[model samples]
Target chain A: MTSQTMRRRFAATTNDLLDTDPRVALTLADIGVGSFNGRNHPDRIINVGIREQLLIGATAGLALAGLRPIAHTYAPFLIERPFEQIKLDLSHQDLGAVLVSIGGSFDAAAEGRTHQAPGDVALMATLPDWTIHVPGHPDEVEAMLRRAATSDDRVYMRLAADTNTSPHPATGELAKIRTGTARGATAVAVGPMLDRVLAATEHLDINVLYAATVRPFDAATLREIAQAPEVILVEPYLEGTSAAEVSHALEDRPHRLLSIGVPNTEHRRYGTRRHHAAAHGLDVGGLRTRIEEFLR
Target chain B: MALTTAPPAVHEYEELGRLMSLMTGDEKHSAAATSTLDVIWALYDQVLRIDPTRLDDPARDRFLLSKGHGPMAYYAVLAAKGFIDLDTLTSFATYESPLGHHPDSNLVPGVEIASGSLGHGLPIAVGLAIGLRARGNPARVYVLLGDGELDEGSNHEAIAVAGRRHLDNLTAIVLDNQSASRGWPGGIQGRFSVEGWAARRVNGRNHEALTQALTTPHDGRPLAVVASTEAGQ
Candidate 1:
């Protein structure tokens, strides 16, 4: 149903992939196992019981054995806890898997600092040749996951409780969503940040670009559509996560960039996701001020 | 990329020593490398069903060196087994050399996983067994862990799951040079036995003992072999 969450959509897509593609398998660390029809393909779905390191190591092993592994868990545990396994086992070994995570940034805000992983994208960027996908809506999860599963490239598919109102095509390229005055600045909205970004830039002259996939960043499109000399990047994860990519895309030209997302500083207080966003200036009003300031 | 025919199982120790000598400098873990020499030799010579000509065969046995520190012995064995040429040993850890301080599967032929980080091999081996079973491939999986490498909590996670899964096709060989800072309580064998693995200890230098223990069937559970070597050897 359209009401399904991103986690549920990921589970459904995984089950279907396991049944349809013999080369596909799933590895879990006792997270999100209840939603899957494990009985149908019991052998392919392995639950390793809260061991994040083994979750990644086993996923690497599956890749080594010529099977495409779908590894899932909460964001911090999946990307941060067993990070060496991701670096050495998958990236270093040249193996491929789809690492799907829930609880993006402060999505588990009430759970406090322990579950939050604002630095996941920043950490992953240190590695080479990984395709990072931040699906904006639950509807985009299936196609992106399917694409990653069928290929042998290393992919990190970020799923979050925060989502946009509608789905955009799950292309790795940046899509020019709204065209503004040619002299206006360009704003790039990544994943769940899109809706807020659209609202933030409402009635402003800047162009809006939607990006579900952040890695292999749509530099070509940005170069093509960036008519203005000023650019703003609003991401769901760390602030300035794609700042370097943007700089690299427009290296020849002189331009100014404003990065707005989660601040590098930690917010120790536990509250609602909205409260966390506002604290970090990621809410619509906060984003509007930053974008306006950058334009000026 | 032509390779020599694998030398027969007999008299591998001396030949291995000769091959190991070619790799000079960067013996960062020489003692650690010496401890695994016989065990690695025995596996390539008599135990594993690997062929240099058929490196990509799906049914071929997989061996993961989780304790990838001091990989001189590993490189020598690969050369002896015809997976790599003898001259490549001289270029070990050099600039642009595929051989590094740790074994990289991408650069080296016949290496299943790139490793140097401790506590990574066994968990990956568990996944390999699970995958091989799912594909109906009869290939067995083996992983070699250093005694010190067990100190890494990641290995414990793998030891628990492989036993619980009853992955009979999986085997873990702990090359115990008594290196763990905090050794396992009641010995390393007990640590695995408690988790339902069929385990035993053997002399590290005995080729017959290693081949026997490695090939032993555990029907409903994975196997663990503690190849004990002298600490300072």
Candidate 2:
């Protein structure tokens, strides 16, 4: 299957939805949807012209005025730059909006450090009552955006250039990809990390699980599937974003965990996504080497 | 629409102080609330077409208190206009009361947006104007800001966008108490004028001046009124 960018699917799905639903509105910070501007409902599709803070604030206001607003922009500009607006305007005011962001982790590695947002999920996790979705494929992006647009809850859908080989249709909970014997190690992969994770553990005896939605982390399912004392968590964004939840899920039993993802240190090196992935030990070979070392 | 309860029998504006006195318990922002007392009163009493009966009406005017740090004046005005019961005034800031230091849209009867942190209200107001316009509703959107709050860059973003979009249904009231660390060189009204908004300056404490300035017609652009008053009055 040919890989597709999640940003393209997001624009298509949102544009289609805007045609039928008058309640649905789109706010942009001059990031996505350059071509769809002419066909889109001029009033519904608001381009705030590079103002990230107003992007969120206006979305909150649209929600306040009884409209469902989907605010889109790059990850760093959407989450980090206008964080206070997200906290006070939307969350504090009890307003609902669908915040869809692109350029996850190091997808914008070529654009330099300013464009990358490895901490988007971790930062959004700080706010209460947010539904965070890290979709791994274009199909998943379409499904998640449709779901979030129909609901009144505050949602943050993180999309990226990195994608799994095929879409995993299962959502809301963890999907068990391979079940191993009890008392062995279990590997949990989040979003786009599934492809590399599957390759890394292809010949191993450990169980593997894939998750598209990370927030409201499925501890119940983890508790049921994680029979072994050793668990490996591989995320696409910041390392150990869900470590506390994993520990809490297994509080009754003493277990060990190995978290693999982008490290905390800034690489500061300009390169491709693959170069950054390899540098952070997130590639298939690096992941396999680390997982094998941990199992031994 | 008329007020839910009978209009207060006695001096209406004078009763604001009495309502404000009901919630006193070592509040730090009593002075801050006093600074916005007259403007809030004038807006609720004369200019705004909102009441408890029309709280959910799409065409009803929206009044957002952007300068939300001191909201005693806001609570008093809501009580005076009968959007909220006068009985709820004494419960302000209590653990169980809906009336907190900063206004919450969900908890309060007629608040359009929750605001306390500076510079959020104006942008939200701009968005509301756009949303209302898209819905083809003629309701006007109004937001009140503190002079010091302009130090936040978010307000500038809203000011520029609203002016550029020609949001004629929106009005921003800046209660300039001369409180910013570095005050605007040409005065706050000039800041709005430079951004293509219809700008005006008035004595914040004078009801007639506030009404006249706020009601001034700005046909094809957003309006900004810098109501000057003493800080901590």
Candidate 3:
């Protein structure tokens, strides 16, 4: 029942891991380690000072030297700016690291487009081997961070300001939160979009599924739970990022999908996060209207 | 199977060049690869405290080839050092060959990173230095980068951060072939000097100069050795 920001929980877990595990190294790009309890080792917790490229390159280097490096910063600087470094230094090198990013989509709406990164998940997906986790709540963030840090696989944990009221501890795959009438259209909510999605489909008789770990795309679970030919995917990132995977999962059956989330166009306006959410038709009322129209 | 030691005479540049020539392919980057011949030989034969037998040793020094496009010299040096079999040199850039246009660390025994993209090695070296230092390991990290690669802002960021952190365990060897669109003002050493790094410009082809430049004590600062050479050797 305890609701907190995913970023706060990420820092807390990372600090704990750094204390217990000497193999763990945390690299920051001028983003100060917030609320981290342990700061004993200066060399391990590196701050590259606004150098996003170095942030990733250093993490790769650390990983190369037999260390589990966790690199974090704002989403754009973390994933978008130094994408090549991630591609070459980590992926191409066959090195592994946990890349945790904050500011999902328009979390920094007041700060404008500079701090936003809706395409991060899609960009990371382009890489052949990356486990992308879009955690909806703090508990999920903590669990996923611990899992990623301990594993040698390439992991990208996306932490954002948005949160669901409660944390579902299920991880590594999709969790069926609510099952509706058989043969009704299925609505899937990814990460932070669960709250708005659950509210939007309150009166509908559709099946609903919640997922935090979107990449490795839980296609099997989705296929098992998808009762009808019609599906609606509501994600917290760029619209239709997971549509292909969903369509591929249900390829044997004819299916129609209504993908809802942040649109492709850049909304240059600066305002609150809610304002941007509403403008993108991601709010409860807007999602309800769109879903109802699609189901009609 | 008894490990056959590489012949003592194999350290000669001619032998290294001969090994390089074994791999016949168009666009082999022969010139670029040959340009770093002396420096690579100096590092492998004289300076680096690593051997093919100790490839997995944690305490052994790390050598990252940043300018990886033309890697004949690297392959030759590794072959000469016995890190890789001499027989594999002929299969360079082939589908079944581990020796590609750029070195892949996963496949190559002594390679520290998979590199071909410009401006990535130095920054990664900085991280390696930090990782080693944190682990209390005394191993030094050396990165070989091309002069053209310095144009990348990522190198500058690494240069600045390494200098600021005083990572003396890290060394960057810039193979200056005068290839950049506009060469650094006041020479390549000046760029490192501005970032509070210990830097020296040496003749790329001179083994003695390279040895001295590479081994020069930097005390608390990271060292940058600018090995100047002709555009194509």
List per-candidate RMSD values in Å.
Answer: 2.7, 2.3, 2.8
lDDT of 3 by residue, A30-139 (tens): 78565554358687889899899999999998987789999989999999999999998999888899999888799989888998998999899999889998888899
Better of 2 and 3 by lDDT: 2
lDDT of 1 by residue, B67-90 (tens): 898899999988877788888888
lDDT of 2 by residue, A177-263 (tens): 888889768898999999999999998888888889888889988998899899999998999998887899999997999999899
Q: After superposition, how far is residue B29 of candidate 1 from its true place, in Å?
A: 2.0
Compared with the true structure, what per-residue lDDT tens digits does model 2 show for residues B1-233? Answer: 22212244223888888889898763788878999999988787668876576678888888999999889989888877777888898898899898989888889998888888889999999999999998888889999999999999999999999998899999999998888999899889888989899999899999888888888789999999999898656
How many Å off is the CA of A22 in candidate 2? 1.1
Higher-ranked by lDDT: 1 or 3: 1
User: Under the 3 Å rule for N, CA and C atoms, how many clashes does model 1 have?
Assistant: 0
What does candidate 3's lDDT look like per residue over B123-223, in tens digits?
99999999999898989999999899899999999999999999999999999998888878898999998999999989999888888888878999999
Error of 3 at A208 (Å): 0.8
In candidate 1, what are the lDDT values of residues A80-187, reduced to their tens digit?
A: 999999998899888899999999799999999999999999999999999999998888998899888889999999998888898988878998899988888899
Model 1 RMSD, rounded to 1 decimal: 2.7
Candidate 1 chain B weakest ten by summed lDDT: B1-10
**What is the lDDT, from 0 to 100, of the residue A170 in candidate 1?**
86
Regions of model 2 farther than 4 Å from truth: A1-3, B1-11
Which segments of candidate 3 are over 4 A away from where they belong?
A1-3, A37-39, B1-11
